[model samples]
Target: MLERIREGSQGPLAMTIVGLIIISFAVTGVGSYLGSSTSEAAAVVNGEDITVQEVEVAYQNQRARMEQQFGEQIASAFANETYLANFKSQVLEQLISEKLVEQKANEMGLRVSDEQIKEAIFDIDAFKIAGQFDNDTFKAILQRQGFTAVSFRDYMRQQMTTEQLSTALTASSFSLEDEVAEVLKLQQQKRDAQTLEVNAADFAGDIELSDEEINDYYQANLSNFDTQEEVKLAYVSLSVEDLMANESVTEEEARQNYQDNIAAYQTIEERRVSHILIEFGDDEAAAESKAEAVLAMVNEADADFATIAAAESADIVSAEEGGDLDYIVKGDWSESFEEAVFGLEKVGDTTGLVKTEFGFHIIKLTDLKPQVTTPFEEVQEELTALLLKDKATDTFFSLQEEIASAAFESPDSLEEVSNISGRPIIQTAFFSSGNYPASVNYPQVENVAFSSELIDDKVNSDILQVNDEKILVVRVAEHKPQRTLALEEVKASITTQLSAEKTQQAALDWTEALKQKLLNGESVYDTLAAKSLEWNEVSGIERFASSLPSEMTKSIFSLAPAAGQDVDVVSLANGNVGLVKLTAVEAVDEIKAEDIEATLQGLANNNSRQSYDSFVAALVDEATIERITR
Candidate 1:
């Protein structure tokens, strides 16, 4: 149901309620425009190529975006081959549509000037440093993402072209008064309904069955009762947990591991500071003397640090506001300067003049964050477990290779492999291909158990890695060939099934009669009361009301405003039927001002969406297109 709501948001009204509607106007050339060129095309639109590399890159980018946005809940679906193929196909189609749109834009003489692209790039916040655009930051970001200035500008041009086309299409769709009124009337509409439940199981209780009927049904569907071929496995398992049971790390070892990797246990500590740098001139003593003067000024009782910094600091970028240099980790600055900064004991403490290669400096510590190190005793147990697991992991993998070789050298039994791994041989009961027991159902063990090498050829399997912790080698101990079940075995079950089908059919036939009676304007309540079925009255039902079944709400709303004295046969769960009589239709005679504006916007969006879809469809119809499979 939540999925249904998410899908419903794609419609005209949902996005408009939030005041924006997005149209897919991706310029497919962004992939190729960013610099990875392909000679082979996945699809060709008119004279232009939609390259194979482009589709693959787009597939990756889109897959990553979705996985990040939705997180782990839906991540596994991408591993499905069919889902990924269909996903790629949709991307290819979008690329084809984009190609057609690009051609149309060119034919329409749409143009984007270089100055426009420049302005767009400047306006982007990602290219800015200290609230203003920086050329180095812009170039570095583009270079990291594999875009040259020329190519990025070309990509921007393509984006602007598509956006211009979209704007033109949007402007052509204007909402008329009647359109808004008609939409508002339906959106605010309500209905009242009379409902009756006709249960199949109620009808089923009175139905009769006979020996002849059961026999006929059984013979007709005998193939449905065929028994699956199954196998029993003789296997040896290897696991980190089993190995850990025998593995241990001594106190000394845990302590040594802690000391060896202590760097990882320490968090970086730094100080936020504001410093006044005074550069040395021809006379080095004068610079030192000058620094002394500045220090004295900052030490005065009534000094404002920011006011002094703006007036006197030499680092102009930071000086515009204050002498702030942000946070500096230990290794980031000159040794003397860093020592002076870290030496200050608390906030607002000043470090006396310290000389560096660049100049002399007076520093104020505004904030200090001390280094935090986890105590050795605090993590002793954790380190022991980690060390045990590491050793067990190594032993498990080593045992895996030894057993794989052992099973292959012996080729017929589990005794040799089991001895090498120090685990007892396990036997699983007969299970069909996919239904192995928890102990033996490790990854490919299922298919390996049923494989001809184990079943017919009778050889041991190579070691299968179920996961990081578990591994298994399987050989079939027994094989049960497929067979059809005898008639006596399924006869009673078939009888129950056939009886239920006949009862449900009988109920359906009775519903048709009930529907005809209602259509003929017969008294609904009296007819229902005669059958001992209650007719319930419900009022003021909305279209998407969760109180009622979605199907019932849909049925109630299907009735037109003038649809009076109506009766319709609707389906219910477990093969029942709902006979609905929609009695009244209520629509808002007046709406709030905000809702009226929302309805108007919704109508305009609907028009734009319809026009965009039609325009794209028309372009697709007129194009010459060819698709190439990956």
Candidate 2:
């Protein structure tokens, strides 16, 4: 289901859904029970409320990921009003789509049992240690991700149910072989070309920038130069691990825990056996005769059972291994097979022909292991650690309540909670929206640090849960307001910008003039010779070649001119211009089998995705969705 969500690429809405899946694990009903009224809802899908906080959290998480990927440049990009608005809309739409999917899944009667949820959690690589599920590792990771055992289980159940729905929708998507072949031909076709290029810098020096133009430009876009609001914060945190470090479990406690969970130490008796089978197909009598003969050989003096079984057994899987069936406990095999295997009382014992659904079997018992209990002394260390953790969990929650109460009662400072919880108060350097201090990574921290209440009234923030075992209370220590730069302070920057604009316009103007001259019976070679620019000769180049400029290739391949009128104007990516002339085109009549196979796979995948996308779109259109808040 997660992979299917990520595979969608129709629009920003699809990508937003993928981003939400990456950043969000579980959130209660869209409105988060902030209020009974729909006024606080970010959206309402089929009358189900989506809260403002939910959308904000999703948007903030997406912004954090973008900032991490692109650094300071992403912050600048977010400053654009248009981009920010579009992004928020897309995020809200994604939340609505999620709710729709969940509703559809429920309507379809999709369900995930407790056992399935447990298996899925165990299969997750994040919760595994050394390729197997470890309780300690699983708990620690869930705690770090702000999930309790119950909540994480619920999350996994929801994920599994949704996956069932997704699988059903996309199971029948495919593509035809001929469609794939056609795409391969088009994608592999190559073309040849030659071009004369012009650089924008050549004309930039000729165009001049005026003081009036620079002043007007700077005054018109003042928001571009404004600084973002920033704040400094002081906070105190309580951690469960810190309490566990000083807590210990005595031998008495360990013994009591072991006694309380004594059933976990019990094991069942198991057996190891081998068998030679004569399968009963069309002739049951023949099978019985062969089994009788094998049994006779086993009973004969100096007769090796393994050699006879290997040469005569119809069970090919175990024949090479001397008919070794490894190990078996009760409920591990068929009723008849189980009865026969356990009937033997001692090792090296053989049973007479045993009848089963598969055939007649000559059974030999090789080993037996009786049920046993692990002594308390052998598991004392493990028990002690478990008891200590349980005690720490109890103490941790107790401290959390105490600290929250103290912080709320004394809002002026965190000193009371810090002393009561034994956690020192910490301060962060100044930071702003979309740009946070490395030490402070939580979105709630930034939100509280910059709120009007924190800045204007200077009150302590409400206790915020950073994770399953960590809680924080923050207060603002300093504040900085937004500011805009004056024209005098940004005159040089404006001048540089205006110069680039003039140069681009001048280059476009020059290209237009050259194009008109070519259209009016001017020779391309003669014009380039007069202009003292060399022509780059390219032959048999691909439409998607990296050797030539992307804009040049796009223009050359968009449409071909008549045989004698192949000259066309193209814009280069470096704010320059180009005069491209198509020379020749080549067609590939055949492709390698491997290439065709790869192309076919890609086409099938894309077609399946398109079908799935259409299904989702149709679901959305039929649903009643309303924007209650923006």
Candidate 3:
């Protein structure tokens, strides 16, 4: 029962908590500047100080996650002043909300034990190796994400507590019968529609825009023609590959490593076992007596063991497959089951009735695989490669600091760093600050290159970690200021834009006239059909039907009248005008059981989300939050 409860709703709560802790957005990494601020407090929530360093760390962590998820191009877009301000505001709000939630949890006497936190952490797939939690992997991941053991454990505790609060809140918000009925009514209601599609391309040929119109559009939207500021960077990057090119592992070192970790190469013994279970339901005596009888039958020399097991075994899943459980290593099964299977020495050996929590099992040892290890000579190459990589990683880190220090000391050029670190000075072509060179795909390089300090002071930017194995040190070679393109230079582009705008307007005008005509009980279907603009009759489509196009469905379902009701002209995403008319509307009285369940579940989820949002909103309104920094 405890296991069932623990596994209930699976790991969504933990995932949700993690998402809250590290909310991803472009507004991240801007907090890095706050790390050095004299004012420690970034914000104060109910007299509690939210430190600048905390915001910086959160920003950096979330930025790294965003960079990884969306790559440098998308991440770089968020580096602008406006986006950063918005991002910081969002981050602060999230932090405040988290504090409020944590305070609420404390007030409610919610307590998450160390054991529970450990269990939650261990359950995370990211920290798992071979299906079990790995301590080293956990530490490594935390380190990569800029977290310490103490901080991460506290984070987990807070997350778990908040999750408990959330679970309670969601569970408390029950699905109302009326709400479900309304949802069912909406879902079940069907509309028959006739659609007329007007292609924008058809009207484009008829659109002729005057130069006055084009000039007006271009003049009004001058910002669109303005080019972004660009920079050319000269930098030197250090990677494990750079070290690996020169690094080599001696035979002696490889042999020593092989000897030290020999167990890693050795295969563990495995057993293939089949079993027949007789569960003790109401009558334990009857179950035990049946298991004993099955064991006796299996012990017979000519007994069809699989046939008997399939016919009589209470474990339905295994029974259907003739009770054949494939090869399993040690620690893969329950203790009693493992003990019973491992105790049987020879193939075809059957165990007597062995009782466990589930039931009594008549176990048969079907097969066994002996432990084996590959010869040292066969794995010598593999071991050498591994050792070389490890050596390269160590060398890369040691030299990374040296290169960064050298680059910073001589920011005007990478020549000094190249000479000091024995790395080549690489220069990039002039690229817009936001649109970086495809080859130099590091986010840190872009951040440093575009930084005001680097551009104005012309100082060597900080040595930035590109990834675990890569480090970059960059200096700006040339900076190009933002500029606006002249009217004549963008005249061709302006003409095309104006033409498309005029065409789209014409299409909308034509669509509106047709819609009005349809509302007045006029049949233009014959006229449209003559021009191959035939009206497609869509019938009995529900709100969420995939058969009809989404735009059509939206336009059709929005109608209230049973007879022809002209819907608003839909300007489709594909630059086509869609005019729709409701031909018929049908109301469904009897909803299917599955439909009801799905609708109710959706309503319950939506209600729970709203409740959580409202709860957070209420907390914020009650708490006195003060911004300490702009």
Candidate 4:
């Protein structure tokens, strides 16, 4: 069912195991199928219509997800029309890719049975409660993820079918022993090198920039000097928790409500049973006959069930304990076995041979707690709290509707909303898109505050969910549009930047002249004396060693040791230059067997991923995809 779909392969071909269930937070309720003819196609893949409604649904889901994770950085991007269009376009492209895969799978005759889909659903951990599958929990979780039972099943079948296709595409990669040993040797290799340093700041004192240069550079890059547009929001924040204190359930109402749903508050009886299991192997009839013989022996007048179980039961772990299985509820065991267990009248009562996947089981009722209905006096307070919570939730939703309507109708300000909902208008200090006030810390509030509807149009925003219990509606109270900073305000920083650029260029030019001298085999000890540069020699450093600058290390390693002594100039990260000289390279002759195997597996996985990418690329090229703007 839900096999380890991405067990080793690492590429788009590995799609994702979540794709197996479409356990989606980014795409709401998108199944692999077309809608009715009246539905409009946003794109067509192999003549299959991906409806405009599907794209919009997936887009909203993705947008909500993006706003939650990346709001601080990309909050302003959402206000840009081009960014919104591109975001929606990405959603459409993903749908088109999925459609192509579905078409290809259909052409290949790949399929998943309904029974397989059921098994997969039952196996999902999200759908389980107390380590057992609960139908209500399954349905609730599915509803939250935007799926009906039928649609999820269809989606599962499509995903599992595609999984089968994905597995086939990368199933053929392998590694040779020699290639693995060679890789292991290289991984153990170390290199020795030396670098002559040239610091840019050391040359800065000799360079100077004029005001004319600074002004010219600033004039050409005005956009870089523009301030980020900011806003102050006037909003009403409401919470269900704030309304809970006002809600109360009377004793009589609690009592009557408890009476109506008493079954829900009662604990289920659990049966603790033990069984002597007889496993069916090559001869099923023989095993069944043996199971019946064991059952007869346990039923004898003077027989000890424990003694017989320990002597003959095929279930080794339970057999050692005289077949003592712990407490179990109705769904814990298979249907045929459950029926036999539940049918037993009392403790010490034994059942006839029960046929199951494990074979036959002679089950004996060890103990049970009878189902108990909790008295109203004992649970009266709990029931009252629940009733009050229900009342509060209902009142909260009603108040939320009032706020939403008033906020939308009275777009100029939150005064109408404050009057209707009785929540006072809150003002936030001026905050940029990323930095926000504690009262309105939610991404939804931040996004709406920066949105055009609230800022440009000066209209109230749609009610935004701060959390399950809280919501916010906002409009920009003050708007500050982006403006270029004057040259006087930014003159000193521009001068410093231009000075650093000149110094860095000087360092590069100096390194090149030294590199040519080193290449001609002139001794570096004497060369350093002439220009005040010295070598930072490091001995036996590995390829990835951090003792030297990373750029210098990489340049040093790139040199072929077989090519004899070499020199290369490197641009260091800290505004400096590096003239690296490779001295020697060493590779260990021995590596452990486990290290070899691990290296081999890693290389093979890389090869497999590349192969899978090629396969998908080929399929994508073969497919005919049309992008429709309308």
> lDDT for every model?
0.77, 0.76, 0.77, 0.78
Q: Return the top candidate by TM-score.
A: 1
- Model 1: residue 225 alpha-carbon error in angstroms: 7.7
Q: Which of the two candidates, 2 or 3, achieves a greater TM-score against the reference?
A: 3
Candidate 3 lDDT over 1-630, as tens digits, reads 223323432466655554444323212322232233464888888887778777767666666777788896657656455667778778778878988988887777676678766666776767679999899997877665556777667766666766677766776667766667777888779888777788888888888888898889888999999988888888877778777878888899988888899888899989887889899999999999888888888878899878988998998888887788889888988897888888888998888888888999888888999789877899999889888899989887787667777776766777877776677878899988567786576556655677899889988877777667777778788898889999999999999877777888899998888777777879877757755798788888889898866787888888777445546688877777888878788887776777768777887888889999999999999999988865
Error of 2 at 142 (Å): 29
Name the regions of candidate 2 deviating beyond 4 angstroms: 1-185, 222-229, 242-367, 370-395, 422-424, 429-439, 443-450, 481-485, 488-490, 511-533, 559-565, 590-630
After the best TM-score superposition of candidate 3, give how far the Cα of residue 413 lies from its true spot, in angstroms: 3.6
**Highest lDDT against the true fold, candidate:** 4
Q: Between candidates 1 and 2, which one is better according to TM-score? A: 1
* Model 4 lDDT on a 0 to 1 scale: 0.78
* Tens digits of lDDT, candidate 4, 67-147: 778974565456555667888888887777677766776777776667656766776666678888899988887666657
What is the C-alpha lDDT profile of model 1 across 158-183, one tens digit per residue?
76665566556755678766666677
| Candidate 3 deviant stretches above 4 angstroms | 1-172, 248-379, 390-412, 415-439, 456-462, 523-526, 529-532, 546-549, 562-568, 627-630
Worst 10 residues of 4 by lDDT: 1-10
| Deviation from native of the Cα of residue 241 in model 4, angstroms | 2.5
lDDT (0-100) at residue 146 of candidate 3? Answer: 55
- Write the residue-wise lDDT of candidate 2 on 1-630 in tens digits: 534432332234432342344224433222221223444688888988888877876687678767877986566556555578889999988878778887888886666678655655665666568898899987777666666777666656565566556655665577666777777777777777777788778887799777888878987898898988888888887777777887998898888888888878868778888889999989999889988988999999987878887998899989888888988998978888888888899989989999988999998998999788899999998888787778888988988778878878988888998998887888988888778776565655655667888889888888877667767788888898889978889888888878877887787787778778766767666655666777788887777887778888877776464754677787676777887878777778887888878876776678768877887898899999888742
